[model samples]
Target: MGEPLGFNEYSAGKAIVIELKGRFDASVALPVKNRMRSLLDDTPFIIADLGQISFIDSSGLGALLASLRHASRRGGDLRLANMTEKIQQVFALIRLDHVFKIYPDVKSAVQSLKE
Candidate 1:
């Protein structure tokens, strides 16, 4: 198993921010995806704060993509913020940066939703 993941959720403007900590991999992907999916019931717009995430794998990426698709279907979107260097590299290498709207911080992501 990998390092256990932690989540801290809060509301900001019209979006829900889910702060992710620890390693994001197959070990925790299902739970993380489930949490994001469940939160969709409350609101379609979500901001995934990845500042504290130390690592990620393909499964983790899949989870985020799945949640993003779900949000899009509901006429909302999933945004990313506070990404670490490692996360940024992975997303860039995979071209996921073009797929998801990434922001420098959670505040900016929330602001973008208003526009």
Candidate 2:
């Protein structure tokens, strides 16, 4: 019995911010991916706020990549912000750090999206 993964979606200007919490592992990846896909279908941009995410696994990483691709197909984009050191290391190891536009804070990420 561990804490389940949690997420919240809200709009900031034209971009949508999805705040993820708890563990982002296989247990929660698919649903989150689906949510991102749905959101991207309407919104032009999405920012994954990882400030509250404590853990992530390979499946979670895969979900993110898939969602990014989906958004791109819709002429939008997916970016990340407030990543923990461990998560950052994982992305770096997988070379996703080069693929995703990561920001130190949500405000910066949103600003980048606006511009």
- Best-performing candidate as measured by TM-score: 1
- Model 2 segments more than 4 A misplaced: none
* CA lDDT, every model vs. true structure: 0.94, 0.90
Clashing residue pairs, backbone N/CA/C < 3 A, model 1? none
Q: Compared with the true structure, what per-residue lDDT tens digits does model 1 show for residues 39-108?
A: 9999999999999999998899999999999999999899999998989998988889899999999999
Q: After superposition, how far is residue 71 of candidate 1 from its true place, in Å?
A: 0.3
Q: Please report the TM-score between candidate 1 and the true structure.
A: 0.96
Residues 17-110 of candidate 2 have per-residue lDDT tens digits of: 9999999999899999999988887896999999888888899999999999988888888989999898898898888999988999889988
Candidate 1 residue spans exceeding 4 A from truth: none
Q: After superposition, how far is residue 103 of candidate 2 from its true place, in Å?
A: 0.7
**Residue 100 miss distance in model 2 (angstroms):** 0.4
